[model samples]
Target: MNYIKHLNSVFELFTRDSRLNPTHISLYMALFQFWNINRFPEVFYINREEVMVMAKIGSKATYHRCLHRLHDWKYIRYLPSHNPYKGSQIQMLKFGTSSGSNTGPSSEQVEEQALVPYININKQNKNFNKHKLPKNENEVLDFFKKEKWPANEAKKFFNHYTSIGWKVGGKITILDWHSTAKNWMLKGEEIQKEKTLYGPSQKRDNLKIIKEKDYGQPL
Candidate 1:
């Protein structure tokens, strides 16, 4: 198989595949590397832990899900090994142009070959609009320091957003994360000022009085 041609063809397919997410692509590329190492074997055995590390997938559940999805979509043929000592089997489907073949398949041929649905241009555009999250906590910390915000606040911001899948309000996608971090900083400052003005004990007492007030009496 022509490595470059295969990659080009597969990537073109990936661009049109809306069902695939980043994790699926990452896992597939990792498997491709292993295939290359094995000299483009028709079939290969893969250890789960090694594949997971290569794909940067932390959870085993995620790894299996993407692998099974790829299998279901006909990108590869997967055969699970029930034995603990043996690795699983995989056979990558050939998508590259062969010596006797045309440069690219026709539209109908491509559809019939992979059973992929019609390309969704709007979904691809929406995926493009998503903001990229920090690779790790250190990146978040570095950005916070560059913005002259407290170093400790970076951890708080990173933790909150990461826990919520880096979304705004846990529902809306974050388009620009730097703006969100700055807003957190401003909110932190306002909270600090409130604490200074009211004192912790007085603030608690004020909240208690408000909660205990009788609404039945005339205003």
Candidate 2:
């Protein structure tokens, strides 16, 4: 599977669910993509730098912050990978139930669940500010008008949004548009609106098509 595309879809799924935080959701998306690509059934070692690069995070500190956040969220369980000679051992992270109920006899079971941490990404934050398009009435209308995006194309648009930054509120609004866009795209109507949806620097239109051959069976 194309890891990047799969990551986009998985990110969308998590964004739709209000229960997940942006950082934890992004970490899980990266973890799942790595697992799917490597096809490792057992524990796998991942370096902090690798995660920073994969998630497009700014720094080692930011990467570790997100990692700790995911651990505290119970989305993943990790431990130091053993090495004969090393400064800091690699990390082995597992994605799935950390509750131990889903593991088999041979599987590693985490006994104590860590207390969840509160890492809020609120609207007033700088990250959130980056996603807020012009809220002005005329500007908003003109933004959409220039894009000529069908109301239904919201899903594709939101996927693009969350891929760049976790815009939770924007995601909620985009989902509503996605529902509307689906019907229009299906009927092959609103071609002009569809063209308008692809704003500058937004490549949601160039999304990689996942063909049946790629799946090798019904998805």
Candidate 3:
């Protein structure tokens, strides 16, 4: 699906809708991410606790309230499974396509276009990871320092990732460390811009992540 167009359609329709509060928007976005990961599947089961964390909701009532509100407002169709084991099934209706029925893409479309999601765990000791990074911890620090990145930030990246074994989403391997660092620099700059644009009080969160690899082997 055309992601930008889809978002535009939602914005065009929902810009004036009073029902869409900040909390609702956050929950919808959380579901939207799952929809993307599931390859735009209309119907999929989800873990409640995981989703709540993903949405940054502290209470089940707040989470369910926004979820059902989205459903009742035709943003999604929710089939509640009171059975925790069964979990709840959610079907996100395509925006600006049709009325709130299950008019979704076929399995073939999903398989062909959607990215499969997976999880990984660090197998090393609690403070170390077995997976190797493309660059040494010191090398990464040097690169960031050379790139004019902050020293503390550089150390923060090294410490966090080395401890976690360079996994993403807990366990996924990062294929390109250089690209990740590039993105990190970009993100830092972006956050700096936001801070400047919005004023000093809008401080960005301080967190850095880095990973490790065996010495002298091809990265």
What lDDT score goes with residue 30 in model 3? 75
Tens digits of lDDT, candidate 2, 57-82: 54445556667655554445655435
Give the per-residue lDDT of model 3 (tens digit) for 6-96.
Answer: 6666666556575466667777777776556444543655655546555666566677777887786777788887764345678777654
Q: Rank the candidates by TM-score, best first.
A: 1, 3, 2
- What's the ranking of the predictions by lDDT, best on top? 1, 3, 2
lDDT of 3: 0.57
Q: Which residue ranges in model 2 land beyond 4 Å of their true spot?
A: 1-20, 81-219
Off by over 4 Å in 1: 99-219
As a TM-score, model 3 comes out at: 0.45
Q: Pick the candidate with the highest lDDT.
A: 1
- Which scores greater on lDDT, model 2 or model 3? 3
Compared with the true structure, all predictions reach lDDT values of: 0.67, 0.41, 0.57
lDDT, candidate 1, 1-219, per-residue tens = 667667878888788776677788888998887666445556766666556656666666677878998887777888898976345778877777566353322333233222223334464455445555688999899988987887788999999999999865465455556645654665576567868998665424533546555422212
For model 2, what is the alpha-carbon lDDT of residue 37?
34
What pairs collide in candidate 1? none
